[model samples]
Target chain A: MQQTLEQKPPVSPKVSAPPMAPTFSIPEPAQMPVSADYKTVGVPLVENAKFAMRDVNVFYGEKQAVFNVNLDIGENEVIAMIGPSGCGKSTFLRCLNRMNDTIDICRVTGSIQLDGEEIYASKMDVVPLRARVGMVFQKPNPFPKSIYENVAYGPKIHGLASRRVDLDEIVETSLRRAGLWEEVKDRLDAPGTGLSGGQQQRLCIARTIAVSPEVILMDEPCSALDPIATAKIEELIAELSQNYTIAIVTHSMQQAARVSHRTAYFHLGKLIEVNDTQKVFTTPDHALTEAYITGRFG
Target chain B: MESSVLLPVLALLCALAFVAGRSRSLAVAGVGGMRILNSLPFYYGSLTAFWCALPSLAVVLIWSIFDGVIIENMVHALVPPAAVEAAGGNIGLVMNQVRNLAAGHLSADSVEPAIAAAADRLVALERINRWALTGVALSFALIGAILAWLKINPQLRARAKVEDIFRWTLLACASLAILTTIGIVMSVLFESMRFFSKVPVTEFLFGLEWSPQTAIRADQQGSSGSFGAVPLFAGTLLIAGIALLVAVPTGLMVAIYLTEYASPRMRNLIKPVLEILAGIPTVVYGFFAALTVAPVIRDMGVNLGLDEWLTISSESALAAGLVMGVMIIPFVSSLSDDVITAVPRSLKDGALGLGSTRSEVVKLVVIPAALPGIVGSVLLAASRAIGETMIVVMAAGLAANLTANPFDSVTTVTVQIVTLLVGDQEFESAKTLAAFALGLVLFVVTLGLNYFALYIVRKYREQYE
Candidate 1:
């Protein structure tokens, strides 16, 4: 058994080297640790994965938007999906909660199971499904209503609280979780649209969390925000992963590296590679993944 | 004939002077002289033309107005004062008859020799006045031409002078429209004041009865016509209310369907058809209401077992109001549709992306966003309903019943005003003067509605932007 382990071939060779460069000897798998509990397989705080997408495919009318893709969103863990523009990362994210159903021409297929139950079943109620899987859009889309009402909209629709006091508690808790309570505690009656972009995005997050969703899907939530706001949101995401499963779609690879425990690399609608964030950045299995990690190509 | 010949000669001379002055300036400084000038060549030509025509036209206009009065007064002076008194201020009528007779259209009977001799003198006076006017006009034209020619030096800056005059002319034209509006308002106010003096202002305003007849003869008894305007106003409101009740919902629904639901091809096809309803002449609608809709409504009421008094009339207010509503539907729908469509598409997307259903989005967001513009359209339609005359005139009854029942015959202020001044009538009577009072009230009401609508629209805009 020791001789067989010593003779095993390397799983990933460094493909980022130039074609004309001198060849280096491939390291044997024996040199790497074989511990049963590796850091790359560190268990998430929540035992069950929240969502498991298997070979998901999406089409927009005649054009294919997302090709066969597979990803796993572990419970109470942050997973970031990052890719170049038009790489179908956002499309893949929208498929998680069936948000793409709002688009008339969009058609999504392949099995996406939440907590081991199929989400796209014909009999399922999309509204309640959306409540369970809340989303924050690229641009902050607070209802053109009062700030308090914007935070209360989802709870009101879902009947999340029975009494006014309970509703207030839910609102306060959600705002607190979104880290927006203190800044907006005074002007709850003002219009939500009057807030800055970052505040509005946070307000949307508070609105989404108000319903006590099991998972939060964020699609470039900080793209329209300033650096300070982006930093705040990144820290919030890190904290949020302790309680809720978070799947963030971002164009910024550094943002993925900074915030996520696991990073999934997508290219041209395909999942090129997904592994532990540090390992995915420092070493990747696929040539496309290696090129993308080193900025050789998208 | 000789004066006509002289007038043309004088006009030709003026035209020649203008051409000569313009050419001389251009010739003095070669071909590029006009380009170097401050203004275009047309300005110089117009300046010369203006100088030539203005004084002459003013003289002619003034002379024409006063010449008739001067000649009539001269003729009256020649007639014996006793004869003028005996004619009982019928002298003007008699003079007209005598002049007709002199022109060889035979009068019914021979006039008195004094009147005939006066008429002949009047003709001679008119001829003399005409000759004097022609001479004055020619002399003025000549003076204007000479002055324009003398002022045509390059240093004179003919363009600037012309532009100055042109600017004043434009201002005067603009003021003409404003003055006309003011004059109309003043006339209405004056006559309304006279009516108020005859009938106390309080009685006219608040009296429940609205009869306006007075006994024509002393022998006739108990023929006092009530001047209370309450019945007419009530009739107007009742009809307009019915119109709005029918129009607002239908128009708004049509607008929503066109803007939100219908496909582009369907909208293009249906919008023109609806607009055709607006283009149909109100008189056509009037006849259709009077001839077709009223009878149908009457039969329907009878079939429904209505009492005779409650039965619809051949000229019921309902028919008029319904037709008027149809007439104004395009006005409301088209305007509202344009405003609704003008709402930014991003607003719709935002609502939809929130997972709200399409109907919910439209009901909760789109309509509220477009409420101000919709209100403006509705107010405009209301004003149109109030001001509509032909439909009310033909379909609505003449009696100004104060009842709110649309099936009953009723009259509006516009119809009453039309009847008051339609045929051979004395303009100074209280009946004729009442038309102005009604007109004033109508104008005030419509103006108030317009201003309120505009205010609502402006306020809504401030909130969003």
Candidate 2:
């Protein structure tokens, strides 16, 4: 049996070679570890917590997408998850508001708590839970309505306001908070879809803020915008972070560094590192994180 | 040659042209290298084949369409003027007899000597005409083949020319449907004009009664038919309204269930079964409405303890309307399902992420986004209901009562048209021509409905990323 094991025709001969190559190899993806467990190489915990996720695993059908992601989101802080495309950053971010429940065949395990309550509990009604945790998508998706109606949609549905005057006030306040009140103040009756791309995104942000959610999740909100629009959104995010605890998933490391208080690095569905945004950029503890930031390879 | 033999012969020549064209191009390219050729060899082959077939086939088509008319005219000329004078200038009857004689279907003893002589001349003319057709068509094929073979060279833009011909062919096919529609509309317009010429336009448009009887003779009494179409219009509206009332809500809810609530497996099982309702022939639904639903409704009214004031007929607009609504449900539901599913998942996510329940998300977001498409579907179903004849004919009696009550029997425009046109009648009579006028009105109403529906869809179409 030992001789046969030794004589097994050198299966996967390329895997035994040295792992470093100066030139980028796009066709053959870099070999990643296949262990059942993942390692946390740097700071992956936080002190003052609004959302604490521990040992969480997500599966789509029979394939595991996220493995044992343990991270914490602090109150009034923006935590940005950055990695290459399909690195499970968006999947982990969606886990906070139970967004993955909408997808059939997606199974999530382990604990994810929001304000010390298990959000994934079967008894939990996602209606109020989602009201508390609003989200902005990668592309702007404003409701097909007037600008005022778009901002008023969330408040009207959740019964956040009773009188017309109060609903108007909420819409105004949400728009003001999203920093879109100045430009769109005169044309409240125009269709929201008629706005520019950046304005449409800000309109979506205002719509989310109208519901008064505690934590706002953004999934690559500025990736679809021009540089000037991205700058405006980044500035708006910075101001909004003072009031709401934010979790942002982005492909741009520079955007994450500019807007987030803490940055988390994900590689092959594992939580590689988490630290202050400045420290992660200056001195990343893991080689993969360093390699990604330096543009050596993803 | 006969048509069967000529077609195969032309096809054989075209095949030979294709081979010759390809080989010529290959030989020309042998010294200059294949790169000098303008297009691939297959395109040259196709160009030659198209050239060989198109002109020769056109000749055959023209000959086939006009040969009988031309030959009949020639044969008619051969029948002497004395024979025509004998038939009292009924040249059509005389020609029929001459044709029968030429075919030997008419016995020689029963015909006149002039007709027999004309029949022999007719036979000879037909035989000569066939030979001339075969000769002219073969020469045209030979000329076309030679021209195409002469034009085959490395410099020819064979691919582009072939593509242009293909584009024209596709355009012709597409225009066939439009031209046919134009033809139908023009025919209806001409006949309706004939109808309006006899009956005043004002009387037809605004008349309050619809008894369409006409006096056969000048002395006939109580046979002057009233041509008021108001009752038919009212009946159509009433039945269509009832159908809309029943179909819209049921279809919308079923669409919502299929798109939002039901699991994938349940959806797959239920969707096709719902569509099977659409596949059922309207005639089947007609009898079912007439035989089953009409009596059931009458019995239900009887069981309701109402007095003799409200009498339920065996055939009611209610019966026809209800089954038409059932028939149209699959139309509404299937179209609505497609548009509702077309509402981007991102919008649903946006609503759900705002903490709204599933019902709230669908009502507030998905429905609003899909409303324009849903209205279009409803209009389509409405036109179908308005145009439906079999159900109304079998279920509703043909009484032109201009009443608003659903329990009374009524007649719709479609039913009136079917009844008027079902049996053989003289086309010159106003009674027969009234069918064309009713058809024109029905066509215009449905056309207006479709235009309005399209306007709504265009004005409110939503954009989503």
Chain A structural similarity (TM-score) per candidate? 0.83, 0.90
Classify candidate 2 by CAPRI docking class: medium
For each candidate in turn, the TM-score is 0.74, 0.92
- Which prediction has the highest DockQ against the true structure? 2
Model 1: docking quality category = incorrect
Cα error, candidate 1, residue B384 (Å): 2.1
Candidate 2 lDDT over residue span B376-423, tens digit each: 999999999999999999998899999887888899999999998888
What candidate 2 gets wrong by more than 4 Å, as runs, is: A1-35, A39-43, B27-30, B64-66, B80-88, B215-222, B305-307, B462-465
User: What digit string (tens of lDDT, one per residue) describes model 1 on residues B1-465?
Assistant: 346665577668667766866776676546667667655655666677778877887888898888877877888776766565677867776666656866767553576677677767877887887788888887888788778866665556777888898899999999999999999999999999998887788887788876665556767875776777888889888888888888999999999998888877899999999978888999999999999999998888888877566756778989999989888889889988988887766555445444555676677667877888899999999999988899999999898888887888999989988988898777666777788888998989999999999999898766544
TM-score of chain B of 1: 0.90
Itemize residue pairs with steric clashes in candidate 1.
B211-B226, B213-B225
The DockQ scores of all candidates, in the order shown, are: 0.12, 0.53
